[model samples]
Target: MNIEHLNVNGMELAVVSSDEIVIIDTQSALDLAMTVKYETNVANIVIDKNIICEDFFILSTGIAGEILQKFINYHVKVAVYGDYSHYTSKPLKDFIYEANHGKDFFFVATRDEAIQKLTETQ
Candidate 1:
């Protein structure tokens, strides 16, 4: 796993890439928030999609909502970067599209895009 801290848009963001699934549940989301805060003192993060559980992409499980809520409650703005074309659900696609338009959460296709989206508050 590699974690890097970046300064962008007047905020610091922790970018993490792990071979294993790092965020699988709400608890994992808390854990990651703590880790990133401790390491970089940043509430913003960009994580590789491969490090997140597949369940997060399945809206039926409600995993994504809960996990994202935890991030929000903890003041952690997150951007998940990867290929989202595999998900065929319209709701999920709409969710991602809307998230990308929001300030706190984003789903993007690349690390650079993740950084850009995560940092752009306006």
Candidate 2:
């Protein structure tokens, strides 16, 4: 995994990139956030969606909700960026739409947009 730190509006953000899936479950998601916080002292993170397990996008599995809840509990804001147009589940689409309108979590198309979402004021 490669972690790049960026400062936007005086807020530190960690951009995590990895070739393999990093978050296979809720525990793994929390671990990633904790690792980022420990390494960079940043509460905000931007991760490539490809690094997350495909199960996370399946709303029926409840992985997305569980992982996001862990992030919220730990006060770790995360922005996941990638191409999500391939997902056809309406529930997943609605979940993404709702999350995008809120703080702490975001689903966006690019790294730059993820960074923008993370750095924005609450």
Candidate 3:
């Protein structure tokens, strides 16, 4: 994985890029947050949605909730950026909508937007 660090609005942020799925489960999510924080001293992160498991989009799988909870518990703010237009599940859509309105988690269409959202205070 490649981590690019940025300072926005006096906030430290890490943008991670990888070819494979980085977060397959809740443990992995916590590990990612800890690793990023330790390496970059950043509590905020921006990751591509493709690096996350596909099951995370399926609300019934419970992967999204579990992994996101880990981020919250660890005080890590995460922004996932990608093309989400293909997903048709209503529950997932609603989940995304709700998350977009919150401070901790964000779902955006582009990396620039993700960075902008992370920098803004709710």
Candidate 4:
């Protein structure tokens, strides 16, 4: 895993890039936020969607909201970047659509888009 601190539009963010899959449950989500806050001292972060656990996309488990709520609660902004076209669930699609439009969390297609959206989100 490669963690890099970047300044997008003058705002600092910790971006994590990895080829290895990372499972992010509610606890891990909090841990991630804490790591960014303590290690990088950045409130915003971008993660490659490919590293996220597959279970995260399953809305029925309530994992998505549980994890995302932690990010919001901690005031840690985040952007998930990758292709979401493979997911056909309407609820998931709707969730992504809603999140993309909102400010707290975003689902984007690439790191550049994620950085741009995160910048706009602030």
lDDT of 4: 0.87
Candidate rank order under lDDT: 2, 3, 1, 4
Q: For residues 23-71, could you state the per-residue lDDT of candidate 4 as single tens digits?
A: 4688877877787789899988999997788999999988899989888
How far is 113's C-alpha from truth in model 3 (Å)?
0.5
On TM-score, who's better, 2 or 3?
A: 2
lDDT of 2 at 114: 94
Candidate 2 RMSD to the correct structure? 0.8
Candidate closer to the true structure by TM-score (higher is better), 3 or 4: 3
Clashing pairs in 3: none
RMSD of each: 1.2, 0.8, 1.0, 1.0
Clash pairs (backbone) in predicted model 4: none
Candidate 2 per-residue lDDT, tens place, 33-122, comes to 988999999989999999999999988899999999999999999999999999999999999999999888999999999998888843
C-alpha positional error of residue 73 in candidate 3 after TM-score superposition, expressed in Å: 0.9
- Candidate 1 weakest lDDT stretch, 10 residues: 113-122
- Alpha-carbon runs more than 4 Å astray in model 2: none
lDDT of each: 0.88, 0.92, 0.91, 0.87
Q: Which 10-residue window of candidate 3 scores lowest in summed lDDT?
A: 113-122
Quality of model 1 by C-alpha lDDT: 0.88
Q: Kindly give the stretch of ten consecutive residues in candidate 4 with the minimal lDDT sum.
A: 20-29
Tens-place lDDT per residue, model 3, 1-122, is: 88899988788899998999998888888888888999999988999988999989999999999988888888888999999999999999999999999999999999999999988942
Query: Model 2 misses residue 66 by how many Å?
Result: 0.4
Model 4 clashing-pair count: 0
